[model samples]
Target: MIAIDNKLISDSVLEAQFVCDLNKCKGGCCEDGDAGAPLEIEELNELISNYEVIKPYLTPEGIKAIEKQGKYIYDTEFGWVTPTVNSGICAYGIRDEKGIIKCGIEQAYYDGKLKWKKPISCHLFPIRIQKSQQDEDLEYVNYEPRQDLCKAACKLGKQLKVPVYIFLKEAIIRKYGEEFYEALAASAEVVKK
Candidate 1:
């Protein structure tokens, strides 16, 4: 678990309720840009072993970039850091005959072939989980609550009836579990007043 700012975590856990409305949205979050999630050790191994499976979708340059960077960073605008290659599309991202996008990962989860899967950085969206200023702590930056996002996702947001607290709690619980849910709920409730 990453160590995060208590205050930011509290606020984000509150706001997340407003952001997740699956019914009205077609998982646009999943379809969006590679949110720069770091590959886990297991995931990296999977790629190396089954490189053939995903290689077809990646440009040779992209593959070379990942291979050369090796996930560690030497220098960039952000200074030394672990590079997160935009893995591009989800393997299960498919368009039905009707052109509906579907998640292969969620489908696999439902089918019991995969358990407890979500890209780490993707799961921590709007709530940044990164090293602190001194790299001694993990900071959970709260979502800025973009007005544009509200306009874009409003239809589903309304349908999901995403009360801020509920949405945030659900997000946390989805990633962390019941214990996190209870803690976030407690934090959010106290922060509200």
Candidate 2:
């Protein structure tokens, strides 16, 4: 583990290569999870605040699910999460012409509708974070590749020589700040040697 700030980052995040093969996975992560996308407390507010702006980007089924279930729902294991349609695709998901699922919230952000892109948990996919039991102040960040869904991504990552940390640089920086990412890069350099 590489310790930086309050995080204990797994070496796999620096060693394992990954790049989302959206064409292959077709955004399966958004659909196959047992629950909806995990949301931080603040993300709940962001969804509520931007619902109107984000609504247009959503599919009819998605809007109905959100309307019936509210912006977010509580899960026994995941705490607060975005509501899912028929307990499947995320409530904020829409399908493109190619039938690939896409995040409505992210699309709205790309369209200049909202400042927040999407849920941090969704952004930092394949790297799940949890509070460390060993230390109250520290969190554990680990690479969790799903074999069925992420096979193509793993293959692409290895082919491109892009490590997980580098693959998820933007999301990691967004969650932990630029200095934290710099520290991770430095750690990666040491690991390389």
Candidate 3:
């Protein structure tokens, strides 16, 4: 583990290669999970604040689900999460013509409609950040690739020689600060020796 402040980042995040091959996976992570994408408290507020801006990018079903379930829902195990469409795909997920699911919030951001992209949890997918139960100040940054869904991404990452941390650079920088990311990179360099 690479310890920086209160967070312990997994070695797998440094050693393993992983990049999302969206074409191959078709955004399976967005649709196949037991629950919708986890949302931070700020993200829940963003959804509520910008639902109107994001609505046009969503599918009919997704919009309907959001309308019925509110902007987000509380999950016992996961805390706040985006509401799912009929308990299947996420309400914020928009399926393109090619059937690849995409985050409507992200799409809206791409179109310059909103400043907030998507849930940070969704942004840092495969790398989950959970607060340690034993210590309030501690959080674990774990690289948890789902074999059933992430085969193509894993294989492609190996082929491309991209380390998981590098693959998730933007996300890591988003969650942690740039200095923390530099710390992680420095740790990776030391570990490589």
Tens digits of per-residue lDDT for model 3 on 69-174?
A: 9899989988898899988899989888899999999999999999997898888989999999999899999999988899999999999999999998998999
The TM-score values for the models, in the order shown, are 0.57, 0.98, 0.98
lDDT per residue for candidate 1 within 1-193, as digits (tens), equals: 2122342453543644455444444445544443334443455454445444444434354456557765334343333332333544343354445544444434444556455344444455545444457555455445543354345344454567564546555446665678766766666556667
What TM-score quantifies how close candidate 3 is to the native fold?
A: 0.98
Q: Could you arrange the candidates by lDDT from highest to lowest?
A: 2, 3, 1
For 1-193, candidate 2 gives per-residue lDDT tens digits of 8899888999999999999999999999999988998999899899988999999999999999999999999999988999999999999999898888999999999999899999999899999999867778889999998889999999999999999999999999999999999999999999999
The per-prediction tally of clashing pairs is 6, 0, 0
Question: Candidate 1: global Cα-lDDT?
Answer: 0.47
Q: All predictions: root-mean-square deviation over Cα?
A: 5.9, 0.9, 0.7
The CA lDDT at 141 in model 2 is 97
Show model 3 residue runs off by greater than 4 Å: none
Candidate 2's C-alpha runs over 4 A off are none
**lDDT score of residue 11 within candidate 3:** 95
Task: At residue 156, give the lDDT of candidate 1.
Answer: 54
